[model samples]
Target: MGRPKQFDPDVAVERAMDVFWRKGYAATSPQDLVDAIGIGKGSLYNAFGSKHALFERALRRYRDDQGAVLVELLERPGPVRERLREVLELLVAMDLADSDRRGCMAVNAAAEVAADDPAAAELVRRMLDRTEGAFRALIERGQRAGEIAADRDAAALGSLLVNTVVGLRLMVRVAEGPERLERVIDAVVDSV
Candidate 1:
């Protein structure tokens, strides 16, 4: 064997995720990843195969880490409107609190490379679908509980909520205050 790795692969992926999250796949150089992960270029490629592969890993990590939480949040027991509003507000809080204003990594990835990169597009699509599913289930639950109009289309509303999140995340990337985002969240919750 060549020798044991001096650092953890998992930690490297986490650090790589941060670099990719902040700069995006297209913008992040191989040097940037090496600088962030503190690994040699050859070591990085040898470990992860390539930057694309590492980006995929980082995207998956983001989905599994951040995306799953949104689903769990929506699944919390309570009035659907309240749960929905809370989740949206939580997203807003998170995006605003990020000093780098990195926004959602998945969203940024999609915006930057989804048109040309099928892998990134699919990953982002899945994240959107998962969030949409959560929103749909919550809406259906609300309808069953007599909170939402029985005839309202839950699927369409679910997609709308996903759009709401995507838009909110991107908007906050350049936002100076929370007022517009707060209003948008309130309007979306009311719509649901």
Candidate 2:
């Protein structure tokens, strides 16, 4: 019989998520994952199969944890515009506050490996789709509440907001100050 394994796979995946978030898929070495997860290289492969496999798991973990937070924030009780601003502002703050300047992991993965890797691309696409749907729901709520014009297209606006968020996250990595992000937030929320 095979030897019983040690270390929790869930915790290992969480640690791997952190590593992949900090270092893009191509840049992170297997040793990096082993060191981050506090496991031997053999154990890491035995548990996750390979670096790419581990990365896929890590990306999914990121989706279930960090990615879901945005939807939760959007779903909070408040005016749609106010909630949108709050969620967008919070995301900008988080990205700016990170000392490592690592932007959204899904966005980074999409930029790094999604072109050549179908699995990574699907994961990123699913995240974008989910976020867009949340934004659409919020917009519909606003329209029903008479906060937003009824004639406007909620679905299109949702896509625009998701694009805005993607831009905001990428901008956080290079922004020298919060001024740019603030302007962006103001412009997008006001437009919505």
Candidate 3:
């Protein structure tokens, strides 16, 4: 029989997620995974089957973690617009505060690996859909409460908000400071 494993698979996947978030899929080597996961190469291969398999696990973990936080933020009790502004502001602060400036892992994955990796692409797509759905639901709530204009298209606004966030996350990669991001947030908030 083969030897038993030593590392926690969930913890290893979390570590792998951090490495993948900082380094795009193509740039992160197997050695990087081994080092980040604190396991031998043989152990990692045995646990996850392959780097691609491990990455899928890591990405799904990221989705669950980040997605829950985002949905919670959107679901919080408050004025919908204010809640959305808070969410956007929090994203900006988090992105700016990150020393590595990793931006969103899902966004990075969508840009870097989605075209080539069908599984990764589907994960990213579902993430986008969930976020958009949350935004759409929030917009519908605002309309019902008379906070947002009744005539505005809630679905279209939802799409715009998602696009705005996607753009903001990508822009953070090249941003020098918060000024541009702040302006974008202001414009979006005003539009809503």
Candidate 4:
């Protein structure tokens, strides 16, 4: 009865992720998704429910992938400041590598839809929460080990770092230079 599914769902979602990453959710239509994902309208709906659902899935995937990388990077043996620098460095690298200049899918979504749509907003919120949590934990460990200032509140520092990170992603869209980003990273580490 139904046409056999040709595209791998994960691959399709990754493609959709790129499209949505480039164009915010409000600007992206179902036709855009169909074209980008190479799946028919009927199949797209049947497989992923709707554009909103697909976006949710894609954002989740992005979060999981980024989270895994951040965990590994933070886990590796290095000074906390170096770990922080490496994290920002990696982000700059990704931004520079992308020819299309897609800043960040999650950050873009957070900017565009986080205030209007509940589900979409929640996804973005969760992403920020996870990022803040990671930074907070790292800061806590750094303080305990005398790697950072013990007087600094890791919670506040974590929030600040999360904001800085998202700002870095947004900044990449308009400005890009390794030296510039490294300077910002230095300032962030100094503040911590």
Q: List model 1 lDDT by residue over 10-44, tens digit each.
A: 99999999999998888999999999999889899
User: Model 3 over residues 31-57: C-alpha lDDT tens digits?
Assistant: 999988888898999899999999999
- Go through the candidates in order and give each one's C-alpha lDDT: 0.93, 0.92, 0.93, 0.86
Q: What's the best-to-worst order under lDDT?
A: 1, 3, 2, 4
Give me the displacement of residue 184 in model 1, in angstroms: 0.7
Q: Against the hidden reference, what TM-scores do the models get?
A: 0.96, 0.96, 0.96, 0.92
Off by over 4 Å in 4: 1-5
Name the lDDT value of residue 183 in candidate 2.
99
Summarize candidate 2's per-residue lDDT along 75-164 as a digit string, tens digits: 889999999999998999889899999989999998899989999999999999999999999999999999999999999999999999
Q: Which parts of model 1 have CA positions greater than 4 angstroms off?
A: 1-5
Candidate 3 structure lDDT: 0.93
Q: Per-residue error at 186 for model 4, in Å?
A: 1.5
Error of 3 at 86 (Å): 0.7
Q: Give the local distance difference test score of model 1.
A: 0.93
Output the TM-score of candidate 3: 0.96
